[model samples]
Target: MGKTVLVTGGNAGIGYFAAEQLAAAGATVVLGSRSDAKAAAALTSIRSRVPGARLSHVRLDLADLASLKTSVDALGVDSLDAVLCNAGVLVDGPERALTPDGHELMFATNHLGHFVLVCLLLPLLDASPAGRVVTTGSFVARSVKLDPADPQSANDYQSKRAYARSKLAQMLFGFELDRRLRAAGSTTISVVNHPGGALDSLTPSRPPVHVRGAGQRLRGLPAGLLLHGKDSGARPAVRAVLDPAVTGGQLIGPRVFGLRGKPRVEPVRGGAADPDLAAEIWAASVELTGMEPV
Candidate 1:
């Protein structure tokens, strides 16, 4: 597969590993990280693994929509086979923070930025033979309650809840996008996949190049050990973008209840997966971002 793929937040964690695997598999992998140094390091490591791999990098801060617009145009791609919206902020403070764009940080970075980026990249994706959009979500979505009135979690803010809600928004967008694309007779497939508890501690620590939270490291060692490592956690997302048999609107995750096992298609439930929720959120996202993947 000589397809070109973009991985947002491709400098570390699941994103780094996913970019590595995709580059090795012959896809022209573009790594988008906010830090230029981190992106360069990731590219170096990936090149060492896949000698002469086609790779590039761009600066993109998901918390800032202006950067998202400028960065995509400069990625040196006329088309893309797939895009992995894998970058996200997790475990912020309990207080509600705002991005440069003035929207809630977590929602803006994790969901809104990607929402606009995809809209801007529609032409490129549409030009691909089998275009795919894979969003990296999580199991925490099962426990989230997003208030449409305060979707930004401005009222009662908790780091975990905000993170979970952001992922839920991503899942809903993925499914809704598939529905819209099909209705418009487009071949682009939008798929959602989660890297269930793929911890940073379970992965090789790369110092400044990789961020490590002390508490997460302490807990992740035990939790990730009981489940899956970062490498294994990226499998479902990789499969979602690479597997020809994978269709849109289906979720892929660990075979063992999304904990630790081979990646496979898994069914989802709850209000987050509801069509009405998807429509409502989609409309809200459009109003907020002022863009849509037509």
Candidate 2:
């Protein structure tokens, strides 16, 4: 039987490309999206790219913590080889938004929701021979520090800073999960990866899902040397989940100055490897989400 992988936000951008590559690799790719129309569109697009691709979809709204259990049950699989925690919300507006769960929008969707979802799926993940949880972090995470005390960003809520801090929290969670899994001697592993610099202008067209215009292609040419399309950006996460050589607790990203190139194993930077901070963040997550993965 082929491996089964669930990719959150697989309907578009980096997650979409990752799903396509995995499907082409013969895995059953389950695209997690909140919208039925978008999921159907993505399924068609992927099938167009890779004929006879095995695909499915589950209604997943990461920001709505109340609905995560229903979403997991909707996966309709007993075992999952991997869960790509790739769905995220980037709130760039000046006004800080909150999820239905009352947590910061970005933090809830990007970090806490994934955290709870993984916790609920632990049993299914453990059933696989080598189950893996791949967290999709960001390049911006490399510079920000997550304040465990203010994880929701209630005290200081700059849109950009809040977004960066949420990604940082996710990276910390990934590393800390690896540590916990190792301590428990589980076969499952956790890995963190970041897409260096992915832009729509640089991305190739995937009709019905994504279509880059001629003007966009021309505008993206100059940055091509240093920036890449979302397709290239999807590589590190795909490598982390599918590559046998990738072990737990490792950070992976682009090879060239962490900007744009082939995916490679990179050092964990920006306090992502700090165990104390990770533990603190882990505690905060548990408190905020009422879920724990161990």
Candidate 3:
């Protein structure tokens, strides 16, 4: 195996494609999905593309902390080269929802759940010579203003804003994680990436009834051209995982306006680069997931 890699939400969309490309590159890829059936199908698909592809499917529901903990522990793996926080949710509908962890759904799945997962899996990652954690962030993070007063969005809940906040949290966590890992003198690398636009399987946060087919089709057109293929979106993530030059606190993403292009080293927005916020989020996440720091 090239390296042991785990990708959350690898059942479909950009996650699936990223897993496919990585598996083809000879990595031992673990597909983490919420649905066992979906994961099985994704594994089958990868095998079809890459003969005898080394792949395994594990159940991981980003909205449920217990599920993540149980599934991760059951993996029975000693070490992991890289763990991709590729799962996400876009709450575009009118209603607001909460995760099983009692957090705002968007924040819980997109940020907190993965936050807990990564921290809990640190031991496995640390065992690798060059362990890395790649998190999928977004351009919307630029627009989001982290409201520490209302981290859960309980008092105020706007669909786009919540989603954006979650992405912002992911970015901040990646940066902060870099600092923490370096301080501990661990070889683990933590980095963030954003696809910029819609990938093949852009899943909406709300139920299907809330989305219009025509609107989704129209939105996906320009996105299809600008957003990038599954492999391209995976570039930054793969690079962050394998590239020796990617240092702590660096972001890897497209060079173009917002989408399809090569992976380039980038920086987190100044407004979003507050160490205080990162620390606060980190503490909050640890409490929320009940996962003690390593």
Q: Considering every candidate listed, which one attains the maximal TM-score? A: 2
Give the distance in Å from residue 139's predicted Cα in candidate 1 to where it truly belongs: 0.5
TM-score of 3: 0.88
lDDT of 3 by residue, 1-294 (tens): 489899988877768767877888889999888888888877877787799799998888888877777988977898999999999888788788876556889899998888889977899999988888898888888886887767777777889988888888888888889888888899887888877664543433212211326566566666565566555676777777667788777888887875668889876675457999988888877777777444
Q: Which ten residues in a row have the lowest lDDT in candidate 3?
A: 203-212
Model 2 lDDT, residue 81, Cα? 98
Clashes of each: 0, 0, 0
What Cα-based lDDT does every candidate model obtain?
A: 0.85, 0.92, 0.79
Task: Report the lDDT tens digits of candidate 2 across residue range 33-115.
Answer: 99999999999999988998999999999999989999999988889999999998898788989776678899999999999
TM-score of each: 0.93, 0.98, 0.88
**What are the C-alpha RMSDs, in order, of all predicted structures?**
2.5, 0.9, 4.2
- How many pairs in model 2 have backbone atoms within 3 A of each other, for residues 3 or more apart or on separate chains, i.e. clashes? 0
Candidate 1 per-residue lDDT, tens place, 156-239, comes to 888889888998998888899999999999989999999887766666555545666776667777676458668788889889
Return the lDDT, model 3, position 245. 82
TM-score of 1: 0.93
Model 2 / residue 176 / CA error / Å: 0.2
